[model samples]
Target: MSVFMVERDLKGISMDDLAGAQKAAIKTAAQMSDKGDKISYIRSTFAPEDGRCMCLFDGESAEQVQRLNDEAGLPYNRVVTALDLTP
Candidate 1:
C-alpha cells in the first residue's frame, strides 16, 4: 500500500465539523476494508489558524485515497502520494 497525503481547505471549520469528518473517514475506511479495498486512515493534522487540514492514509493508491475521502463526503483539495523520511 502507498501512503497518501490529502489536503483540504476549509475556512472557518468548526470543531464539531472536524470531529464529524474524522468519524466519517474512519467509517468509510472500515467499509472499504470490509469490501476488500485496503485503505487505512493514519491520522490528521489541522492548522486552524490557516484553515488548512491534512489527512494521511495508507492505501493501494492515491486514487483509492481520493475515493475514500469522496465516499466519506469530505471536502478535499487533492490527494498525493506521500513519502516518509525518517532519520
Candidate 2:
C-alpha cells in the first residue's frame, strides 16, 4: 500500500462538521476494505485558524484515495502520492 494525502480548504467549517467528516472517512474506508478495496484512513491534521485540513490514507493509488473521499462525501483540493515520514 502507498500513502496518499488529501488536502482540503474548509474555511469556516465547524468542529462538529469536521468530526463528522472524519468519522465518515473512517467508516467509508472500512466499508470499502470489506468489499475488497484495500484502503484505510491513517490520520488527519487541521489548522483551525485557516481551516486547512490534510488527511492521510494507505491505498494502492491516488485514484483509490480520491474515490474514498468522494464516496464519503468529503471535499478535497487534491489527492497525491505521499511519503509517510512519521517517526
Candidate 3:
C-alpha cells in the first residue's frame, strides 16, 4: 500500500496536557497505525501556542487512516489531502 498523511488541528489542549508522563493519546495512535498488518510511520506534532496537533500517518488510503484514527480515540474530522516530494 501507498503512504498517506492526515493533518489534524487540536484545539483546547493545554501545554500541561502535552507534558509529563501521560502520553497515552500518542501511544494509542502509534499502536492503531501499526494494527493494519504492517508498519511504516506514525507521527504527531503540537503547536502549543495555537493548541493544535498535526498528525501524519504514512500507510494505506484515506479510509484506512481515518479508521485508525477513530480507533485511537482521536479527532477524525479530516479532508482528503496530501503532499509528496519524492522523485
lDDT of each structure? 0.91, 0.96, 0.56
lDDT tens digits by residue: candidate 2, 3-65: 999999989999999999999999999999999999999999999999999999999999999
lDDT of 3 by residue, 1-87 (tens): 555665656567666754421254456546765664442444556776765665565656777667666655666457354564456
**C-alpha positional error of residue 13 in candidate 3 after TM-score superposition, expressed in Å:** 0.9
Candidate 1 residues lying further than 4 Å off, grouped into runs, are: 85-87
Q: What RMSD does each model have against the real structure?
A: 1.3, 0.5, 3.9
| Two-way TM-score contest, 2 vs 3, winner | 2
Q: What's the ranking of the predictions by lDDT, best on top?
A: 2, 1, 3
* Weakest 10 consecutive residues of candidate 1 by summed lDDT: 78-87
- Return the top candidate by lDDT: 2
Find the candidate with the highest TM-score and give its number: 2
Clashes of each: 0, 0, 0
Which residue pairs in model 1 clash with each other?
A: none
Off by over 4 Å in 3: 19-36, 79-81, 84-87
**How high is each candidate's TM-score?**
0.94, 0.98, 0.60
